[model samples]
Target: MTRRTLMAAGSMGLALVAAPRALARRADSHRERVEDLIARMTLQEKAGQLTLFNDPFRWRPGNVNPGDFDTDQEKTAQQIRDGHVGALFNGIGAEQARYAQRLALEESRLGIPMLFAADIIHGLRTTFPVPLGEAASWDLDLAERTARAAAAEGGASGIHQTYAPMVDVARDQRWGRVVEGAGEDVLLNKLFAAARTRGFQGDDLADPLSLLATPKHFAAYGAAEAGLDYNTTDMSEQTLRGVHLPPFQSAFEAGALCTMSAFNDLNGVPTSGNHWLLTEVLRDEWGFTGFVVSDYTSERELIAHGFAEDDRDAARIALTAGVDMSMQSGIYLAHIPDLVESGDVAMEVLDRAVRRVLMTKAALGLFDNPYRGADPEVERRVVGSPAHRDLAREAGRKSVVLLKNENKLLPLPKAGKRIALIGPFGADRSNVFGPWSIFADREMGVTFEEGFRAALTDASLLTVVKGSDVEAPLDGGIEAAVAAARDADVVVLAVGESHNMSAEAQSRVNIVLPAPQQALAEAVAAVGKPVVVLLKTGRALELSGAVKDAGAIMVTWFLGSEEGAAAADVIFGDHAPIGRLPISFSHYSGQQPYYYSRKATGRPELPEESEYKARFRETSNTALYPFGHGLGYAPVSYGEIVLGSETLPWDGELTASVSVTNTGDRPVDEVVQLYVRDRVASLTQPERLLKAFQRVTLAPGETVEAAFTLTRQDLLFIGRDMAPTVEPGWFDLWLAPNAQGGPHTQFRLVR
Candidate 1:
């Protein structure tokens, strides 16, 4: 397709299937019906429709955790009966969801169907790798399939919407929620955002197996200051629009049904009360028609943010700012009516919010079948099934990134080599399924010992040692670990953060290996056996000490249920490690907001120049391992990048091609990355920006020509006046394996 056609398609929702005339007519009828229902709703009912709360009572057997439910059961039931409750979240299973839906439909006077929502971030029951690990795969299709599986399982369990596909372009590793997002690159984040949305919603929302996808923490929550969660974000308008907003745009265009507002304030206005971000940018400019829900208690937290005086003020601000629903915050139900009655908040704003909420319910077919996804038999059949586990295993294998492999220590011989598996995660099963896997059964995950035994013909060839606790002192266990390594032909040191270390509210000031694990690595390395460091982490960490000096290092970021099996596959050469780093690994923890795509400075530190200018006094100002860097067993070589022409008209396309050859005995998949830099522009640009990339699998001695077509639209950036446009400029381009540096060529755009 032409560039114009592609842009137009994107704007018009390319992810959606073209509906038949009959379906379109039916949708119009549904809209008319929704409007009629809205007209019938009282102000109290309307306020209730914008209120979503957790199920107050725990109905599941043997577990009685009183979540965000109302303490007074009679009052809660009365509220449901009066049509004063819109939806229920954190409801456990099909039975609980059915009970809640029954109360809304059968007990309520208006009989409005309630939407069920949950934080199904990665998986429901059949867990896959955490989202950051999935992004590391760099496989859009795999990411989509993983989402599809999660959606199916979640749907079977009676979930109508998932607060997922967190498209926040996370640049800081210290940000605790990095595990919940795609890494720092905008294009990759955009692609995965769309893919996950399509996977969750499928071809039609009416499909029972599909659920609404929520791309969240709406604005720039990922760029929180000092890598702190919910911290203030201060940046230029250009940076906000250029770096953070594209993923949300992509997700919305890909048919996301809803969005969750961020907790942090952009500039001085909290996202829950930022009308410019929600209405101006999201609705007016991007044409997003979906409803926006506040993050958990975010609307009420606006008071804490000092943006609002009280709950009543918070409700008015958030409602006016374009939030349709309050998640777990009863401020909307308590205060919106008073605000609307006093004319402090417009009646039309309340009506618009209710309309959006009901529209989503209508689209999900909840109005027609309130219990669409609440099927116990389907839940039992689908959740954690054999087929789902296979997919999890496949995803885990693809997510493994080989950061270093000196002397070809990896793809270890499976038969004769005696392996010593040592670390906190050596025989541990629970920590493998990382954070946000709330519903996953820990016992179901494959442990490291289990995986090694499955890969080897004889289980006797492996000696397992606990070594030391993840963060605890070495004590005397390091001696035992060293002795085991001495007896074995090779040592595989499994080390990194525990499952609770890298998720929400789990931020770390020091992003390095735990002292005990580092000490164990040193002791194991002292034994003289080749050491392979298997890192199971959620975010990037500073590779230092003996862990960095190990013969091989593979980052297996919380690979979910099949982590052990997946690691075994790569270690045994069953699968090549093709995954690339979605985020850059900083050399030290002090580089809080480091990424590859920073704007060029006038006095930039160049390798050829002296150290006096813009250089760090103690450390090198570069990522330890740059973004898109990964290694496989087979070696691949890249020829120089070739441009179709040195200069082109502003509206025309420039074709860039490069030949990549696999010069090893084994076939391998190579991720050919294309980067571009605007040499001069009205506004300064990143030194290099990833524009296009292709993953190609090649056999021994096989060379493939990878080409990309770039148009003026691809080079568009936010200018001085905060308008996006492509300016006439000389553009330097690169075709390489990673984002650090490679062969370069230049092209120009002319008016």
Candidate 2:
């Protein structure tokens, strides 16, 4: 169905209004329960439900570090008793959550339940690969399974809601938060968003194993200027609707219970106070019934953003804009009631926001049993279980993308060869889990040395050397690394940014290996040993210097707890590297906003033509590694692309098929990607846009046909008039492994 149609249909169970009275009554009771609670609440109590704050007692057990603990805990406790706080975030354990929930249930006048939330972005205790790494796998089922495991662990920990599945379609690597989202493609982001939402919420929110899924940074937070986090965003409405908003729509359609508003301002309007985005687009147009929460201090930041006069104005604007909850801002708590009483903020608006928050609590069975998922026994049995760890290992393994395999240098022999693992990440344990892994036990992750030794025939065959500290020069580090490389039969150089280098507020202007590490890589490569580069990073980097010329290059994004084991599995040929790049790797840091689906420029720089037109003086126009690019043990070749018909009716289906053959000695899973382009349009179109993709596993010498069906709606675009339209025109289609050149064909759409 079209977005409009889907929006009009609303969420699941809303249709029960027309069903049998018994079923309808059950659905009606949810709303009735929320209404009844609101009736008993004072204006202050109602405002409290729209406010959320961090847990005061979230510090590690027995450690109780002074500065880490909330100093205003006494005041906060009184507020909870007075029904002035709706939710608590960063509640570490079930016991802690239960303690806070008890304050509201037993001590408060209304006995309302308080919601607990946390940033379970990738995983909870048993960390999985970062979101970008998982996206590289291009395996939707695996992504869903990982999300499910995260939800299970989170639910057991008394986390009623998880701020996760950041579905922002990020194209720039310099954006630090890119690690939290799926990469550049809209379709890929949409599919992963939907799958993750389903995994987090499951079939029912009332289930004890389920946690409320929140697809966050509601709109266009990923397209920050110069790839800086929380930077200003300026784009046409067409681009916003076509590119940035689809994933959010997909997540909502998949039954997401909440959305987190972005910190960035779009077109001079802070997202927290942008009524067009939070209300008109999210609620009225897209029919998202879920509550919208402001990003950390985002409502208060509206003053900093120059969009509001003060804290009171910020609260009023955000409330009117449809932001139901103010995260850690205290704007809603401090000023919401006065605004409501003074008639600056309407009572209906406050009630609407309060109702939405209460409905979510009811859906989670928090009203019936606030501690439904907060069981100590369940926490002990499920959190970081052996089964979850195994899944993490598999997820990490699949996320590793073989970027360059020169002369088949990978799948190193398990015996005979002396392997030297050199670089900062060689034996690093803490950095493997990456960022936003708040609850993960760093000690649980296997070190590279441990994993490699386990995979080797003899433990003595491997020697590990910490070549240098990340971004820091270590005295004599390069010399020690070079000596180790010279003594070994081959060298595995583990290098890339540390976890902190690519998360919130960590944007880098130079997205290349640090100078010290670049120097270290060159020194080791000079030893003449076959060097394999295992790049452990959260975001795409400009691979240059000696590292780019290594015999093999693998992009192993922070593969969470099983990083070491997963890397060893792929290196030792226990598993084939099948991941494809979801984002393009630029050759130069100057290519900050580079992507494969760029619009056709007026002065196009065709590879086959002269370099005088739209050409860069220092670098080529192409990406270092294009989107969907990767290699496996076996080589897969694409056959001729065949279309069922040369012409398709406006409302009819067009089937496109291609035969893929595994031409090597081993089995391989290949991602068959399909791209389409409009030959002519009122508004110029992208050179090619990703339309369809599927992963197929084929045995040696096996050929399989993969087909994709496209309806006229698939070609729809936001036209110059700012409405979706599919003009009758000629179109070009290509089937390939990546965004690079491939076999092409042409077709037409006719009315």
Q: Can you give the TM-score per candidate against the true fold? A: 0.95, 0.95
Segments in model 2 whose C-alpha atoms lie over 4 Å from true places: 1-27, 58-71
lDDT of 2 by residue, 608-684 (tens): 88566786888777888999999999988998999999997887878888999999999999888888899999888
Candidate 1 has what TM-score? Answer: 0.95
Model 1 has an lDDT value of: 0.85
Number of the top lDDT candidate: 2
lDDT tens digits, residue span 1-751, model 1: 2323323322212133332233234346579878888899988899999998776643322222224345566777788888887977765577667877888888887899988887788888778999999999988789889999999988888888999889999998999899988899888888889889889888777777888899998989999998898899999988888878878877876788689999899999999999999998788877677799999889999999998999999999999999999988789999988888999998899999999898778778887788987778988998888998999999999999999999888899889989999999989987889988878866789988999999998889999999999889656799899889989999999999998889887778999998888888888898889999999898999999789888999999999999899889988999899899999998999886889998768888877885666657767678999999999888899898888899867878788889999998888899888888989888888999888778889998999988877778777787777776777879899988899967789999999
What are the clash counts of all predictions, listed in order?
1, 0
Model 1 alpha-carbon miss at residue 235, Å: 0.9
